[model samples]
Target: MLENTQISILGCGWLGFPLAKHFIAEKSTVKGSTTSADKVADLKNAGIQPYVFTLGANNNADVYRNFVAESDVLIINFPPKRVEHIETLYPAQIQEIASHIRFRQKVIFISSTSVYQNTNDWVTEDLVNQPEKASGKAILAAENILREKLQNRLTILRFAGLFGYDRAPGRFLANKKELSSANAPINMIHQDDCIRLISAVIRKNVWGEIINGCADVHPIRKRFYILAAKKLGLQPPEFKEETTVSFKKISNLKSKMLLQSTYKYPNPLVFVL
Candidate 1:
């Protein structure tokens, strides 16, 4: 149980903030970090010990060192920025964070499904495919770095395309035109599921493993986006017809088996919020 445990969240935005709140509600102490100073007050108001911490900008090294050192569980939750040489740069960033850890603290690295490319079939934690996109390649590199540093007490959760509440998929391609991959299936998971999956990881004590968090149903990209747009009263986007389908359906069997997770929004087609 998380009762009376100290947990640290490295990137306390969106998913991290909510996860911190969840920890607090469980009677666990939480330490949260943000790159923005504005969010520090918000985190403090919610009873989280907040630190205005930024990677590579090491103006105050002691602040981050204490943030990493104090916690029994550390959740590293951040995405790589789209910058030049991200493949090299992102791993360097992870390497910096990994340096601070006290050897064997339980660490959860919030990774992405982008680590796997479109293989036109099912992609599980077992399959390792070189991602096609620049960002994906960067994340993959970052994952390997973390694995090397905290292999003993680490759990890497690779979530699918995140969408829910304010982050509506309808807003993504609502007014776009001539988008490709119409026939391709969309792999996505909602915000609620992401949070629950993280909690499941801690409760089950599933460490030193890699798990894929996603829905079971894979919906066609064109159809899901159209419904998502209509649900929000947005102009449905147009897509080019495809002769064949291409996709990498992210399998959640490992998460389900390990975390005992049942997705709240299994099908993205019915997702409005």
Candidate 2:
């Protein structure tokens, strides 16, 4: 679907690099951004046109403008690390991007399911975002900013906790003395599934919609990690807390209905086992 279209990814860290590679595989011109100059060559080696850039604080508006202006589709994948001042800085970064780009270009803003409050219910795009933390509030505000400016040209994909490659659940809990929320339900999406959902969006040209991107399976946190460790021949992790944490389960039905997309890794538990 995106045979020759130029796609630029802002923030080529864990999620961004794989996304850029996916677009390039689809025969699209991929431009990936990294705040560190050291990563520029790595991105280029993967067939991506890399740019050393960072948003927030004293950002260069000119660079942001040029990148957005040049690309047919722009994906904002940067994470706001300073949660203390995210309310002010996050929206400003989105505004910085929106101010530079034309209204005609389609923008895909990669958000997180952390925007949802821990309500212990299935969350859909139709539900209003009620972020409990500063990070979530900032992302919600950024979504609002994009919607207000780009209108129907903006698409929001709210993803669950990410795990893949070297970042498997087993490794996270391996050799741990104590783990919390062992029985709590784990809602996560593999990196491959994330890329698949994004690719489907690009192929379908689905815009002006807020979609939840997550896997189909939800496993109890403790059991999931124990299984993962067992498969790796490692000792199962021990849990300190038996109480469950209130968390929202994400649904991907809207994405499936809209794009007719099939997840490559629907059950993240499979990877752990």
Question: Model 2, 1-273: lDDT tens per residue?
Answer: 889989989888998898898888889998888889999789989999877777764658777776776699999998777767779988887888778877588889999998998778888888877899899999999998988888989899999988888776777787686877666677788888888888888888899899998889889888888888887788888888755577678888998899898788888877866
In model 2, how large is the Cα lDDT of residue 254? 94
Query: What's the CA RMSD of model 2 in angstroms?
Result: 2.0
| Candidate 1 accuracy as lDDT | 0.87
Every candidate's lDDT: 0.87, 0.84
For candidate 1, write residues 1-273 as lDDT tens digits.
Answer: 989989999898878998999999999999999999998789999999998877887656687688888688999899998998888878878888888889668999999999898898889999865898888888888888878877868899999998878898989999899999998887899888999999888888999999998887888888888888888899999999779766899999999888888989888777753
Q: What root-mean-square deviation over C-alphas does model 1 reach?
A: 1.4
Q: Which 10 successive residues of model 1 have the least lDDT summed? A: 55-64
The local lDDT score (0 to 100) that residue 142 gets in candidate 1 is: 81
| Alpha carbon deviation, residue 103, candidate 1 (Å) | 1.9
